[model samples]
Structure formats: C-alpha cells, structure tokens
Target: MTIDSPSLAPAPPAPPGDTAVHPTPARTPSAAPERLSTRAKLVLFVLCAAQFMIALDFSILNVALPVLGKDLGMGQADLQWAVTAFALPSGGFLLLFGRIADLYGRRKLFLTGLGVFAVASVLAALAWDPASFLAGRALQGLGAAIIVPTGMSLLTTTFPEGPQRERALGISGTLLSLGFTIGMVLGGAMTDTVGWRSTMGLLAVAGALVLLAAPKLLSESRHPQRPRIDVPGAITVTGALLSLIYGLSTAAQQGFGSLDVIVTLVAGVLLLAAFIAVESRSAQPLVSLKMLRRRSVAWGNLGGIATFSMMSTVVFLLTLYLQEVLKLSALQTGLIFGVQGALSAVAGVLAPKVIGRFGARNTLVGALLLQAVFTASLLGLGVASGAWLALVGVSVASVGHLGAIISYGVIATSGLPDDEQGLATGLVTSSQQVGITIGIPLLSALASAHVAVLRDGGDGFAASTLGGIKLGLGVDAAVVAVVAVLVAFGLSRRADGGVAVGGRTGGV
Candidate 1:
C-alpha cells in the first residue's frame, strides 16, 4: 500500500526477521491507522513542536546572555558557561540517548525528555546563583539530547521515502530555522521587558504543552526482543564526550596549556579511545562501529561538523559585534539577526527542490562553496563598508548555510535502513552540536587574541576588535571551503548511485 505522506512512505518494510526482533506496536487502531490517517497529522504536529522547542533553546539564550550574566553576577567566562552547559550535554549524550530510544521506544523517550526539559526550565527560571543556573541549563541540555534524536527517528519511521517525507522534512527544516529566529527576537523582548527569567519560563510552558500533546499523537515502537542497554558503553562514551567538550570549551578561556585543561583533555582522549574499543567488541554496541567504517557516514559527519562550526561561530561573533561594537539595542540586534534567520528559513523551504534537481551531493557541494564565498565576503566589509552591504552579505551567507544544512540532512539519511536511522541521525546531529560548542569558544578566543595583538601594536580597542572579527570570519570561510573540497572529491565519488565511502553504501 502507498503511504500518502511523502515523509511516511516508500521505505521498505524492515527486513523480515527484523520485525520480530523489534516489534514496535502500531498506534491505537481506534486513534488512527499506521498507513495514513488524520491521526498521523497530529503525530507530526507533536513531533515538530518538540523539535522546534529544542531548536529554539539553542538560539533563544543567545539574546539573554547579557542579562543572565548580570543577574547571576557572571563575567564573560561564566556567561560562556551558560551556553556551553546546554550545548555540551545536548551534543555529548546524543548517541547514548538515540540508542536508548531504539532499545526502548521513541515516543516514550520523547515524552520523558519533554518532562525533564520542562522541569529544568522551571529550575532555570528560579535560579538564584550562577551555579544553580548552570546546573539547570545542563539538565535542559540532557533533556534536549534525548528529545531531538528521538523526534527525528519518529519522523523517519512514520513517513515513507517520497514527496510526503521530503515535504515534511523540508517543513521541519524550515521550522527549525524559524525557531532560531523567533527565539532570538523573543529572548531579546523577554530579557528587555520581563527579565531574563521569563525566557526560561517560556521554554517551560512550551515543553509542558508538548508533553501534554505527546500522548495523544505519538505511537510507541515495538521491540519484542529489546536489546540490553549497554551501560558501560554509554558511560564511557558520555564521560569521554563531556570531558572533551569541557576541555575544548575551557581551552578558550584558560589556554590549552592550563593544568586543568590538559588533564581534562587527556582524560577525554583516553575515555573516548576506551569507548571505541568497547564498541568494537560489544555484542550490541550503543553505536555500531561498522557504521563508522562506512566512508559516507564518516565524511558526511566531518562535513557536518565543519559546516555547523562555521555557522555557529559566525552567529556568535556577529551578535557580539552588533551589540558591543555597533552599539545596537537588544531589540535592534535581534531585528538584524532576524533577517539572516528569515533568509535561512526560505532557503530551507526551497532546499528539497534544489536537491531533487541537482542531486544531493552536487547540491551539498555547491551550497557549501556558496557559503564559503559569502563568509569570505563578510571579511571584506567593515563599519565603513555601509550597513546595507553588511546586511546583504549576512543574508547571503545565511541562505547558503541553511541550504548546506538541508542538503546534508537529506544526503546523510539517504539509503539507511529503518533500524539504523535513529542512531545515525543522532550521530550526525551530535556532530553539529559538538561543532557549535567547540566553534564558539575557539572563534571567540581567536577574535580576542587578535584584538589584543592589534591593540598592543597601537590600534584602539574598537578598530582592533573589528579587525579581529574580520580575521576570524576569514578563518571560518577558509575552513568551510576546505571541508567542501573534501566532500566534493572524497564523499561525492559516485553521483548517479548512492555515495560510497569505506566500501559501504547506505551509512553516508
């Protein structure tokens, strides 16, 4: 039978015996049929809402950082921690949580994650000190770590591969970009008028709504012979990721040579190495090592990491420049950034069509190259370059970045079996988050260092600061270009057929 929703059709049934192995129950017959029904739309709504909530959290707090820093008596470094706290766990625990969803049920994990996220947001709103706020944010991250991947898995499973799925994915991508834009604007408004606490309160309310709607819409996947949760694998991997992210984030502030930084870095490396070894041997590893062996997955993940790193760092630095250097009000800064978000949303909506025409690999390579060009263009403009020019470059870059992201999303999931979809999606999404966490600090530090050097050479703080931002953007552009080149040659070996990497076809 043909599934109506493009998102829900065209996927071959799970390999014969696999269904017996993972016997997810169909949604209640009284509610809606699995094939296609009005009930499925409700399911999609809940999933999209959850995904949007998670996406909003990533960018919403950007506008609140200044206010949060002041209220909690935090300095610059402490403020960075607020963002890092959320990003680190959100990225670090993705793989573990994805595996849990597969072993358990996506609907179960998603609702549970929403509950945790809501509680965490409430705690964040009431926090009286930096430590408490940071803790709350960390918990929020943990919740998001579970919510995002599980939600994606649900979409992948619910929809079949076709126009319906493609359209749904496109809409989902648009919603994500829109959420980021809305978050920035909402965050600024809340921070300026109601206070920073209101921002967290907003997330809490949204999360609660998602929790309420989830039960009605979502169906639990069956797992007749549920695989045992790999506790050791989860622990080692989580620890390793946390340590590595913390170390990388800390390096921005304390320098890589700091004893604490060195210790964390070493510990993270060792733990990660140990985790890989364990996965290679485990009967049911959290992440299939065999998946990583695929060239498509490996290179696609690397490209995702590099692309998101550039995008996140650009957003961070530009926000700072708009506020501190250009002296724009919070509202104005939000408005300016909103333009970029709008362009990205538009690009996301159009991305599927572009991919269909050009093919995924070609579209991805072109988008990345365009992104690099736009990023480099930003380096050529300054305060004297005119506001219109700056805005144009920013919008162009935003469009390209969004296009690249959508392309990657489609390309990465192509040809994967249903069972592996959750884990693979989680890994790729985690790479993006990890890139953001690592990118912000590293790029910020680069800008700061460059500013110091220029100041020492007699340029005033303002001039030096802008100069530093220019240099940092240049570096970001270069990195993106390099990654695009790698994808073009290494990952895009076969155009007509699916991408092949490491002798595997589907994983990429």
Candidate 2:
C-alpha cells in the first residue's frame, strides 16, 4: 500500500471474507513513500468539472424551456420532448457504458464522453428548429450517460478507498449540487440578458476545457479479465429504462391515461424482467446479481434513490409554488435556490466528517430523517405568503440532502474492488439519474391528479395548486421517512457486531 499524504493512505486490509464479490486486484505495499502528485490533483479537477457540467445541463434548460419553445415556435408536447429527449438516453445507458468502460478503458471512454458532450452542446446552441434542438439534446444525454459513470469510475480507481476517496467524492458532490443551482441562476440571467443559447454555449465551453486537460491527466484503467459484452442483458436493460423514463416523463405532462404511457410502461416492466433473467444466466453479466445482493450496494442505492427523488421533487414543487402561486420572477426563484446551493456546499464539505464519525449507514438514515422533517415543515407554507418558508425549508433540507448524497456514495462504493468500481459507481450514478428523471414525474402526477379533484370540488386555482404542492411535500416526506427506516433495518449490525453492508468492522 502506497502511503501518500496522511489523507491518501489506504485503510488496513479487511479481515478474511471481506474482500469483494469479484476477484480484486492485489493491493501490495510499495517500498517507497508515495504522494498524490500535482498531476493527479489536476486530474481530479477535470473529472469534477465534467460532473459539474453534467449537473448544470440537468437544470439549466428548465427555467429557459418556455423561452426556448417560443424561439423555436414549438408547442407544449414539443417542449416536453426537449426535456424527455435528454433524459431518455442519459438514464437508459448508464449501466451498459459503465461495464464497457471497465472492459475496454476508462480514460478512452471519459475522453470520448467529453468530446461528445462538447459537440452536442455546440449543436444545441446552434439549433435552428425543434427537430435539430431535440436531436442535440438527445445526443447531449448520451454524452452525459457516458461521462458520469466513467468519470466516477476514474475517480474511484485513482483514489484508494478511505479518507482520500471520501474527500474526493465530497468535493465532487459539492460541485455537482452547486452546478445545478448555479445553472438555474445563470439560465434565467443569460436568457433574459443575452439569449437562451448562451446556456448551451456555457456547457460547450466547460466541456471543451475539461476535454483539453483530461487527455494528459488521466491514466488508463480497466478490469484485468476483459470479458465479452453481455449483449442480451444490455439490450433488455437499456430498452427497459428508455421505455420507463419515457412513460414517466410523458405521464408528468399528460396523465397516465394516455395509451402511449400505458404501453411503454408495460413494455418497460416486461423488458426489465427479461434483463434480470438474462443477467442471472450470463457468463459475464452486465451487472452481477450477487453484487446487487450486497447489503451496502442494495441499501445504499435505496437511500440514494429516495433522497435524490424526494429532494428534487420538493424543489420542483417549490419552483411551481414560487412562480405560479406567489408569482415570483424566475430570477427570484433562482436566487432562492442559490441560497440552498450555498448551504449545500457547507453540508458537502462536512459530509465526510459526518460519515467518518457516525458511519455511513447511520449518517444515511439520519440525513433522510432530517430531510423528511424539514420537508414536512413546508406544510406551513400558504398560497398567499410563505416565501420565507420555501427558502428556509429548502435550505435546511438541502443539508441532509447533500449529506445523504455523499454518505450513500461512500456506502455503495466502499467495499468494492478496482475491477468492479465501474459497475458499482454505475449503480450509484444510475440511482441519481433515475431518481431525478422519475421523481418530478411521479410526484407531480400525483399532485396534478389531486389538484384536479380539488378543483372539481370548487376550490380556487391558488388553493388547488397549494393543496397539490402540500400533498406532494407530504408524500415526499413520508417516502423519505419510510426509506430511512428500511435502510436502518437493512444495514443493521450483524451477529458478530460487524456492519452487514461494507463487510468490515463498520460499513464505510
């Protein structure tokens, strides 16, 4: 084990039976002292920058969608496509590309993703019509799908597990959240001042800069046993995710009553079943069912999806409340999220320490509970004047949100070996992307359905909207609360007093 800085030193070897599900690369100690070089630090910067750009694109177009639709002479369904196109490929292809990176080369995949993202951004910026713009967005989503899992695998492979990996993930998670908030602010400001195209231009520049630096800084890493592609598993899973995301995204805009939504959803479920069966029997499965059976991977992903979904849904609801109910300007709503972003930064910085002290399982459950409490507190909000409540609830809940984000990553990836790092991080990023994609649609649909009922009962528009928002918040809180309990039980202490998750004295 190479001891770099104190922070970079790898943890002591796990006891027998605690290694990994797959064969791990041997971790032999180096004779000489090893320090994380300036080049390695620069590499981390580039990786994080790429992740920041990915997160930025997720939220940046949201505020500018109306402007974009008007400029392109597009209607409501077309606008929905703008968002859905990006989400479809991004959420669908994560697991496939992640396994590919491990089989081929992470550095090669990372560079390819950055190039694709930069070019896609330029294409979107220069789009002349809805067809061109949707094409660009869909390509950008593919780029994002490749970038996130590859970059994360690179990060994990570079930094040995322990304080070093935790710290690096903290910085990356911080920038990720900050990027989303900053994009919201920048999207509104740039759209009003310059043009909506500038948002795409900004991503283009970021991607280009990161791409330029990454070639030199990144080292090639891949699994030792390069297995054949799991073609059947890949096709089934990818098709399943695309269908599911489309069904859910469509249901958010239109109700679930649509034939397309119903058909696609059923298709998605059927494909998912097929994928599971394929993976179970494949010689080299795209995803290992045994790995998924790991306590850490299973519960950690559960917490991750829950936290991400609920927090994003809360933000979306508040965005509606701010704009439609209180009639705040987009810029004003962005600024409010800006404050939450700032608080999130603080939380991110502190997350590693919180995990270190409380253990990842405890920290995850606690964070979810904190998030639930603060989210439920938003019930105090009214249609007339509850701007402060929105600001306060979101800001406070964001701390737990960030904490959960970091802790879940730590838990999910902690016990995994180098060969499987890509697959493990794939699961983590999948949780994130799938969460963000589904959260708003699922909760918003419920809210919309409720609002229709309220309106039918003779409630005013403002009252109906408020009632819907409250219902969403309540469900969000309830979901998080329940998941927190499940995670607590799922990752509970083992008979020997060791953690059941990470296969160590304590998980993470």
Clashing pairs in 2: 1-28, 1-29
Per-residue CA lDDT of model 1 for 245-328, tens digit only, reads 998888888877789989988999999999999998999888888777555566667777887888878877777677666777
TM-score per candidate, in order? 0.88, 0.93
Taking all chains together, the TM-score of candidate 2 against the true structure is 0.93
Cα lDDT computed for each candidate against the true fold:
0.75, 0.86
lDDT of 2 by residue, 1-508 (tens): 1112234443464433332221122343211112356766787798899999999999898889999999999996778898899999999999999999998998899899999999999999999999999999999999999999999999887776655676678889889889888988989899999999999999999999999998877778888889899999999999999999999999988789999999999999999999999999998899999888777788899999999999999999999999999999887899899999999999998987776556677788899999999999999999789999999999999999999998888888865677888999999999999898889999999999999999999999999999999999999999999999998887774533225333222235
Instruction: Using TM-score, give the best candidate's number.
Output: 2
**Cα lDDT, model 2, residue 190:** 93
